[model samples]
Target: MPPPEPGDVINYIYLFAHEAAAGRDEGVKERPVLVIASDAMGVAVVPITTKGEARSSRSDRIPDPVARAMGLPRAGESHVVVNDVNDFDWRGHDVIDLKTGSFLYGRCPPTYFQKIVRAVQASAALITDRR
Candidate 1:
């Protein structure tokens, strides 16, 4: 199997977030979710490469410097660390990250790659069971 494009990752994560939001009556039908542990525990399936080489071909989100300059404060003072596309343009197999602790992937602290992987893996079970 081949790897997923960055946009696919973003879109799927968005899809999972929408599903989870509707499930919780959170009125968040159209946006990235700020999953809180205190609320219903939901895992978001996301993709992550261990290196910074594949981003060169990715055409997703714009540069962070520009985003910050444009006053893009994350929801409720939250933040995300995006690696340079130039640096991560074609890296390794995507790894699922954990969601409850600190994570440092290639100098970027995403903190939830493995958890997303586990969540997605669990979801994949239904497909497996059908086999």
Candidate 2:
């Protein structure tokens, strides 16, 4: 099948804030990320991190099956870091462009993407106060 699009999964290099301090040089290397949205500008993504020591409102463990479907590395277990979400431009970042064969990872199903979106929404709402 074709690779990830909007509402799909992808392998991404999530650069740390400190790493990007000087420029987009250092980063955590390859990690799994969910494609929440995409446009002419770039893609809005949610990263899946291996750090599970602490659970936050913006993080959730991804199901094994979903991870497998998404072709995520270390698919057995992982957590999606929603609060760390960011948009990356195609030109400025090293992304897996399926059309150009830039990177050769696969994409997740829409059902799984929907689940991730819901989790992100829930996390976003968790910080809101009705009072």
Report backbone clashes per prediction: 18, 0
Candidate 2 versus truth, CA RMSD in Å, comes to 6.7
Where's the lowest-lDDT run of ten residues in candidate 1?
A: 83-92
lDDT of each: 0.25, 0.60
| Candidate 1 backbone clash number | 18
- What tens digits encode model 2's per-residue C-alpha lDDT throughout 13-66? 765433444465545576666777766656777777777523343567768887
Candidate 1: segments with Cα more than 4 A from true spot: 1-110, 125-131
Candidate 1, residue 25: CA error in Å? 28
| Alpha carbon deviation, residue 28, candidate 1 (Å) | 16
